[model samples]
Target: MGTTPLTPGLAPSPGSDGTGVVEMYAGDRASQALGIVVEDFGEDWARCSMTVGPDMANGHGITHGGYLFLFADTTFAMACNTEGSVTVASGGDITFLRPSHVGDALTAEGRAVATTGRSGVYDITVRRGDEVIAVYRGRSRTLPARPAPPAAG
Candidate 1:
């Protein structure tokens, strides 16, 4: 997984159909299936958003914890990978500040708080409007480039 870092303040802004970093988001089936959109990104930061759907609700009639985690995780992925490196989350944890219901639109903004070598710490805030819904922290590691496939015999 390799890609060129996106130029700052470029076009094809999120919610569109493309991204600058190797179009990784374009190939991301999970985010796509969840209707998560990379709304914007720069260098080591990214903003993503999605609307809560009925399917995302738990039996309690509120959004499931897993969905919030996934949304934040996806935003974390976008933030870390902005450097064009093949980054993967080593681990992550979330703290829910409030519960959201279906039909509520939520946004997650992620910033790389610190980066030394291949390791980085990211902080993400998930919000519904001006109200904070959750906060997430993620650790990421950039994977080494994969070896080329064997040549044709």
Candidate 2:
């Protein structure tokens, strides 16, 4: 498929919220079901986070791989679509770096690395504190921009 390029100094800051893009992504029921919050949303990048609780743990009490994947994927979705159009990931792969534990707040950030025509590549990183727990590369397809509706009569 496609590949994601890396952005220099790409990272997420804390305490920022309510951005229209973030709201479009994380304010949905899917994000709420996963306990995720979008902390930052920018034209070229996006970030989301969630608390690793008991409910997210595997039999060994460690955060499950699926949770990490979803977090990274969600961030990927937001970053790719931050330009105010619908974006969908067509393919993705994630690498686990370290295990996450209960009570650890996990954050995932994504940056658009490259785009060709209607396809885009995104790089996603999942972190706990300063430690990276996972890294992902995803490809997205951007839908055609929609036109504004006619004014009311």
TM-score to true structure, per model: 0.84, 0.78
Cα lDDT tens digits for candidate 1, 1-153: 122133334454434333434467767877778888777777788888888989999999999999999999999998887755689989999999999999999999998899998899999999999999999999999998889999999
lDDT of 2 by residue, 56-101 (tens): 8999888899888888888888787665567788999999989999
| Model 2 per-residue lDDT at 13 | 37
Question: Model 1 off-target regions past 4 Å?
Answer: 1-22, 149-153
RMSD of each: 5.8, 8.0
Could you tell me the lDDT of residue 93 within candidate 2? 96
Candidate 1 residue 57 Cα shift, in angstroms, is 0.5
Candidate 1 Cα lDDT to native? 0.83
> lDDT score, residue 31, model 2?
64
Screening candidate 2 with a backbone cut-off below 3 angstroms (N, C-alpha, C), the clashing residue pairs are none
Model 2 scores a TM of 0.78
lDDT for model 2, please.
0.76
